[model samples]
Target chain A: MRVPVLIRRPPEILSSEITDEGLFLNRRKFVQAAAAVGAAGVAGSLLRPKGVRAAEPGQDEDKLTPYEDVTSYNNFYEFGTGKGDPVKNAHTLRPRPWTIRVEGEVGKPTTFDIDDIWSRFPPEERVYRLRCVEAWSMVIPWFGFPLADLLTAVEPTSAARFVEFKTLHDTEQMPGQRRGVLPWPYIEGLRMDEAMHPLTILSLGVYGKVLPNQNGAPIRLVVPWKYGFKSIKSIVSIELTREQPRNTWMVQAPNEYGFYANVNPEVDHPRWSQKRERRLGELFKRATLPFNGYADQVASLYAGMDLTRHY
Target chain B: MNQVQWVRRVLKPAVFVAAAVPFGLLVKDIFGGTLGANPVEEITHRTGFWTLTMLTITLGVTPIRKVLRLNALIRLRRMLGVYAFFYAFLHFTMYALDRAVFSGLGLTVGAIVEDVAERPFVTVGFTAFVLLVPLAITSTKGWVKRLGGKRWQRLHRLVYVAAIGGVFHFLWLVKADIRRPVIFGAILTVLLGYRVGVWWVGKGRRQRAGHVVAAGASS
Candidate 1:
């Protein structure tokens, strides 16, 4: 102590070494301004939808296609045939106050209000790779519960072998319906087993927010293992049927679009090769995987069937 | 200035700038990152569109000259044809980059050869582009003089075939919406029809003149 200070006195920091309070505050303000600008720049490039965030980690290595690309570049013939037409014209769609009619070979035939389905299902997020038959693809973060859960809730009867989904048929709401684009009230279907697969979902939202109208607002089907067209949009009805439901594309061009529109690279479309697909936000075309890279999860379902024949 | 001088100095420059506008705008869009998510597709489409447009315009020049009695318009035809070739070249380049180079195929000619051989759409598009090569090379006045007017005119008629191939290439590629390609087909039809009508009228006039000369000689 007095003889020799037990604790050595710490060297004092010079006034120059200590940052001035005004300068520190100014630097923080500058940093905040820079950060705001950087965020704005990212938002501008992405044209991000409201309330949407980046997908949670470990979902995918491939970057999520920007929200703008997902919404704007749509193939919803219900809106129009042009790639950009959906975003331009889909505002006419009324997504709220919606109901989905569930019937046909079910124990409980009922129409579910959109909100009721939302609360009952309570959508969880799933990132999926969407492959289009047109040889383009996107990675999308879709929010939905399993389609099996909904099917179980409806209590499908033993006679149910297929699940048929239909879109709204109003010409006023969907202007493309005014023209004979693809036989209105676009229809899609899946085998009961395929529908029951956990990978299959009835999507309520995308990018962690309510879906934009162009991306099939309120509710749509998301079959991650199949082509984008197989996942029909804006469902007004879901029917469990005995026979397979003829889908819109198959009805329109039977030779071109098959009933089972699974993503098969070896089975090419009549008009073009399905071997390669241009991923959104990428310059080069990548080799398309069988079942769009979800073969591990879904290959067992089609173990014996010849995909080429089915495709 | 006289009309010809004005056309040479002012109108020609204006037309050149007008023709280049689409390409310039495309370049701006490319650099500005406004070509949307799939820039290669956008580039391919824009170039293809302009190629078809330029071909149509080139084909329309003769008819426009005859209809409006503006003989000076003939001067614009070669320039327009060259512009069509320009766009076609860009379109083909983009395809090669997409299918061969950027596709991680290592920029081999073999990859491009395979594309042209295997893909029917590419086959037709490549044919159309190949058809433009001789025409583009011999576009100058010197080559026109060397080939002689009749031979040069006969050789350049290949443009009609190229135009047809271009239309079919477009028609074959589309999935469902054929409206745009149909419109292009319609325009090409009207232009070719007009050319045939003019040829028929010229043949009739030549036959009549020959018969009159024979009658006078016999009398």
Candidate 2:
């Protein structure tokens, strides 16, 4: 069932030119490979190939997109906007030179490099639905440790009631900065309990592969219950604080964006109805599920609060 | 008016240039695949907006000609009209692909078209768009020669009706934020109003003169 494409292989281009143009193909080829691999994808299945171990049901990692899909195609603004932009642009990010600074209401304020942090917390697999503010939602199987586990290791002080995360602020890396739409070096925050919630994950990879730069490769937060923006990406710093943290989107359009940023049907945006969403892949087929249908798991978090206010 | 002609000659590109700035940015974002999520709507809205914009410009051409005392202002009409068709085609495609238009839900064409009517904005927008299809087809130079100058001018007056329909289409489409459509509507009204006022006043004076001549002859 495979058809061969005729290609006349000429002499390879020089290394510098190869880096310039040839590097783009690696990302393009990654997509081509994913499409090829998808040829074997059975209907409505999460990539359970023949003879290879299928992820068992109830296993969080079982229903995840492969890591190659996760890291390469992402919405991590720290790297860039498009799923492909990250892989193409993240090389310039200097993940090696990156170090996360932690402070605010902590007895032992610690600043750690990417190496020290990963070696300690390690990566765990969690299948979570990422619902974007713009109405598209996706089911991603992310590989990362729980925010609670990481916080426990760091020992947040009792005074630390809020946890704020900051993305790397380089006008060079984050092209959105050039436009100044929502203040650069995007910042997001969560209440202390929400930050420590087991459902909250600091994503490292997806689909059993490393994270795509666009998908917040290297590191990003994944809050399954809330809208995806609450799950910040390309994190460069973490601050433990008592006061409310300044978030980018909420600051820009307070009426449209909310602090909790949960997936709720009752809370409609200024322009569009939140009552229904287009499920990914089923975008042309099925309608979206409400609370992204994790209401059973996350509804308790917003039991008494007026969702309209939080919305 | 030599200076005036020079300015307008420069401004013809400037209008297209101004129009293209947004298209370029949006295109770059889309082509770079940087439009993020819900991409289909992003492209739809962008293209739809330019459709209305170019239509507004096309409608503005005649008034601009009269107001500026420059006959050459009429020259931009053809190019602007074509651009309107270009963007309008994009807008039409977006809607046709939407669930409201051609649903993969196995809905009948009658049902699909009915669903579009159920949404008032879509209904009005569809009406305006359908009205433009005839205008677009008749814009050819051959069609101009075929209809003859007077008939063709009469036929192309359909562009005025299309412009009004297009603005109303945009106004109906939005649920809130009437500011944008209202601004566009005001501009379109002024453009159309200029011609209507001139026609009405000229007709009234001619009628008065005819009455006087008839009375003089009778007396």
Candidate 3:
């Protein structure tokens, strides 16, 4: 007998949900052609919002941050610490021919080829508001499938309580790893429930094109309710563990960064205020919301736990 | 032309133009839409960087003059220090506008006061800026003469303290990867170390001179 469905799949695509086949096929061909020249060419072509779906209900209604900003202004320490460093340095990262090994506390441990996973779960477009701990925010349209689909396929054991992710550790490709800026191969984790949440997606593309190398090419986690750092980048391996896994920032500065990095405006970062955030390209700063404004759906996950203490 | 005339007419103006280039470029970038996604942050960082850089160079003036025997370089120090203050003022203004008015905090003094009081980085940065204010005001020749050489010299030493504060402000602000701050700290250490070395040698010389005077009188 088949194992029970561990997590819900995204709802079936309705007849109206389908796009014009000819237009979709042409767009795909154009993306492939751009990809042939180089990643740089693809970057220029993909930035235009052509054939992108509208924001799903409950997604942020704010204007999407410019693609240049999303790709240029990143906090990927594996590439470098400066916001612009990733765009300059991430060209060293090779995204194709990548594989993710899913193992530990799973009934069927498997290594998934990046292409296979792409074909297996056709990406769905999602607009999410990503708020950084530094009090900057962005509205991004990410194209990817629910991560629950992967975890369900692996069939997590009952003992598994946390899901841990690891970025690639090649110093040649990721030169920033050579410097002891942070513990190498940047690691992040989420509670099993958080991992299985419908909002958590394994993003392969953004702005209707293949993910830019700077913005965690190949695959990255996008947990909208959590701080941007919680959504780890360039994931190479995933492990389900019984104990809560210590994330990179948590390891680096335990007092400042904690396991549950849910966006809570009430809890200020020790060094700076978290009550307000400057949405990229806006002149005025806006008051930040609870769970980056997804409290309605995600607040139940931390019902009785003290967020300030966890943070 | 004489050395002083050449410095006044040619060298000083050249240094002033060179110093102002970063600010000019920043304005150009702001207008050209090349400051990237976060232009405010870009402006803040660039201005702050130039502030610290001018402070470091100001501190370097004496060490370089002594080592290279290019005392003409002394003429440039006051201008450099003034530039540091200029950038510090700009940096702080950017922050105030970003935090107070643009942030929708209604330009209340309380918002800025709270930031200075609550954040250690802001505290140190504000301290550096406050220390520079008097130095910049008293930087004119007339004020220097009124204060007298010894008093002015002693007062100007506050630049060292301001430099220390500025370096720490930078060190504390970054989230991680402190290579840049550490580099600034290392350079400051060497500059401060040179001063200590000179002071120690002068103390020894003075003590030896006193001994010679005593021997001469006894004989």
Candidate 4:
């Protein structure tokens, strides 16, 4: 296995250029401005969600969830399955000293330090509505770069069709791992194209600060358009594979959770209706949007496929 | 007034107020903005908890009276069961309202009926609540006089079945972390166990008495 670092890509193939043509043309200027601000140590403050300054193009303008809600009400089941369990029990997690093993069918199978990945891909604020499979939603201002950038750096092989993410599995820190609620070392995966989608981000921060431990600190996947569980937390490994990898939730209950796991209101989970969702901190439930309101950007990915059957 | 009258007028009213405190607090929390994030869930969770709590308490009334000889506690069981139904009603209403936005028609009979039939958790909970309706209605003195004591008692035994359904509803709905529902299940087991034990011991006593009478007559 070989390890690689920050392999620069052609300017056109950049994940940032894939979005808007205007933003693509102004990429150099944005990078220069970001570099200058990054040098001054004001990067953190600049990325903070305040007014229109933190609003990114092609993202939701919904009111961001309160920092208290974003931090306290979490679904990181490693700590525990309860909504409040992570807040109370994740104190034992040591996020700083962490390394992610990036391997499997890539040109360079590398072990990258969490900090290295953070610096290599400068964080960008993306306000996303995170809808959990359990029918609750929250609009979170996540700070991270695209997963495409990370995959680009590692250089996936042509044979690689899926990317699997493995979460931290320390029983000492994550008390819930000791019990059999879910298979330990929770696993989640995405198709190669879905993994390379511009909206799929490797989140490191929320509300402009480094993530709280309970909210998957160090590093985590944030696939905004999919169910929140698809965005695996406290990631420890990224493996590119030829075959579709088994996801934890899907493995536990296949009928309830499918491999696609896209946010589709039309296809209901076996246990409950998916047409509506309770947005956190909101009084009334809101009608769920197809692909979590990212249908324009992501709907084509599933063209000609039977979503109900896939679901 | 004497002690019996004092207990009837003052103590019974006190129990009623105390039993109502949870619902009042829930209402206050809704208006006070203190139910925290996801107020719908908070409302659902709290009301569900109180429903099960009151149901368990109601099931324990007979056992408590028999053990401690506090027969006046029998008067309080009706109020306790009513509170359980009241909370269950609130729980069902909040759940409907929570899901109503998805329905084409808002809070209509069709939508509720569809949900009750479609979702297993809702089905069980709705069945439990529907069972409680007759119990609450027949709890009145007039209904008791009309139905007669034996038939009334038999119909009221359905509360035990309703209580089991409520627990199963809770157990089935949880995504993960079955600890809370499991704890509730344990409590129900103990309450039901006490009732079965009392019946078994009484049957044994009756059998023994029959044998003794037969033996004396033969001798």
Top TM-score model = 3
State the lDDT of candidate 2 residue by residue for A185-290, as single tens digits.
7899998877876677786655545555566646788877788888887788899988988888888778778888888767777645565454343224233345
Candidate with the larger lDDT of 1 and 4: 1
lDDT of 4 at B137: 92
Chain A TM-score per model, please list them: 0.81, 0.74, 0.82, 0.81
Top-lDDT structure, candidate number:
3
Top DockQ model: 3
Arrange candidates, best lDDT first.
3, 1, 4, 2
Q: How would you encode candidate 4's per-residue C-alpha lDDT over A156-220 as one tens digit per residue?
A: 98999999999998898788899988988899999999999888889887655677899998899
By lDDT, the better pick of 2 and 3 is: 3
Model 2 chain B: worst 10 consecutive residues (lDDT sum)? B99-108
Q: Give residue A109's lDDT in candidate 1 (0 to 100).
A: 92
- Tens digit per residue, CA lDDT, model 3, A1-311: 11111122334433234444345435544643544421112211112312333222123336557677888999988888899999999999999889999999999999999888877887776768899999999877677888999999999999999999999999999999999999887999999999998888898877666789999988999998899999999999999999999899999999899999999889999899898887776656677889988887788999999888988
lDDT of 1 at A11: 35
i-RMS, every candidate?
A: 6.9, 9.8, 8.0, 9.9
- For candidate 1, the docking band is acceptable
Better DockQ candidate (2, 3): 3
lDDT by residue (tens digit), candidate 3, B131-155: 9999999999999999999999999
TM-score each candidate. Answer: 0.87, 0.62, 0.89, 0.82
Off by over 4 Å in 1: A1-60, B1-3, B214-219
Displacement of residue B4 (Cα, Å) in model 3 is 3.5
